[model samples]
Target: MTVLATPHPTGHPGYSETLPREPESAAVARRLVRTALAAWGLEEHIDDAMVVITELVSNAVEYGRLASIRVVVTRPAKHRVRLGVVDRSRTVPMMRTDSNGDRIRGRGLVLVDSLTERWGTDLHQWGKQVWGELKCEPPR
Candidate 1:
C-alpha cells in the first residue's frame, strides 16, 4: 500500500492510501481515517468516519474493477471532514429499498446517510468517487 499525507489546495491536511481491493483493506482504510482525524484533532468524527470509510471500501472491493482502490480523507473546511473512496468502476451506488420503504441490502449506505451531513458520488471519466462529509464545531 502507498500512503500519502499532504496539504490540500485548500490548505488543509489531506491523507490518502492506495490499497488492494480486498475485504481486509477496510481495516487499513479505517486506520487511515483514524490517523488523519486524530492529526487534525477531529477525534469526534472518527467513529462515524470509520463506519463511512468501511462501507465505501467494502462496496468498492465488492463491485469495483481494477486491482486497487484509493481511500481519501480531507478537511475541506475547518470543521468539516470529507471521506472518500475512489474505484475504477463507473457504476454508481444506489440505496436499496423494498416496497415497504424499508432498507434492503444496501443498509450500509443508509447508515452512511444517517451519520453524514451529506453524501454523494462524483463521477469521473476514469472512475467514480463516493464521499461523505462530517461536520462539527472546531474545538475551542
Candidate 2:
C-alpha cells in the first residue's frame, strides 16, 4: 500500500492511502482519519469522522471495482474536515429512506447523513469518490 501525508497549498494537512479493497481496510481508513484529526487538533470531530470513513470505506469495499481503494482525509478549512473514499466503481451511494431498526443493512448512509454536515459523491470517468464533511471549531 502507498501512503501520502502532506500539507496542501492552503497549509492544511491532508492524508491518503491506497489499500486493498477488503473489509479489513476500514480499520486502516479509520486510523488515517483519527491521525489527521489529531494532528489538526480537531479531535472533537474524530468520532463522527470515524463513522463516516468506515461507512464510506465499507461501501467501496463491498461494491467498488478494481483491486484497491483510496482513503482520504483532508482539512479543507480551519473549521472543517473532509473524509473520502475513492473506488473504481461508478456506483453512487444512496440513503435508504425505508430503513428501520430491524434491518441490519442499508443504514450506513443514513448514519453518515446524520453525522456529517454534508456528504456527496464526485463522479469521474474511472470511478467515484464518496465524501463527508464534519464541522468543528478550531482548537484554541
Error of 2 at 31 (Å): 0.8
Model 2 worst lDDT window (10 residues)? 4-13
Every model's TM-score: 0.89, 0.92
Best by TM-score: 2
Residue 104's lDDT within candidate 2 is 90
Clashing pairs in 2: none
What TM-score quantifies how close candidate 2 is to the native fold? 0.92
The number of the candidate with the highest lDDT is: 2
Computed on alpha carbons, the lDDT of every model, listed in order, comes to: 0.85, 0.86
Please write out the lDDT profile of model 1 over residues 1-140, one tens digit for every residue: 66677644233338888899999999999999998888777778788889999988988998899999999988888778889999999999986554435535456888788889999999999999999999855467
TM-score of 1: 0.89
Clashes of each: 0, 0
Q: What's the residue-level lDDT of 77 in candidate 2?
A: 77
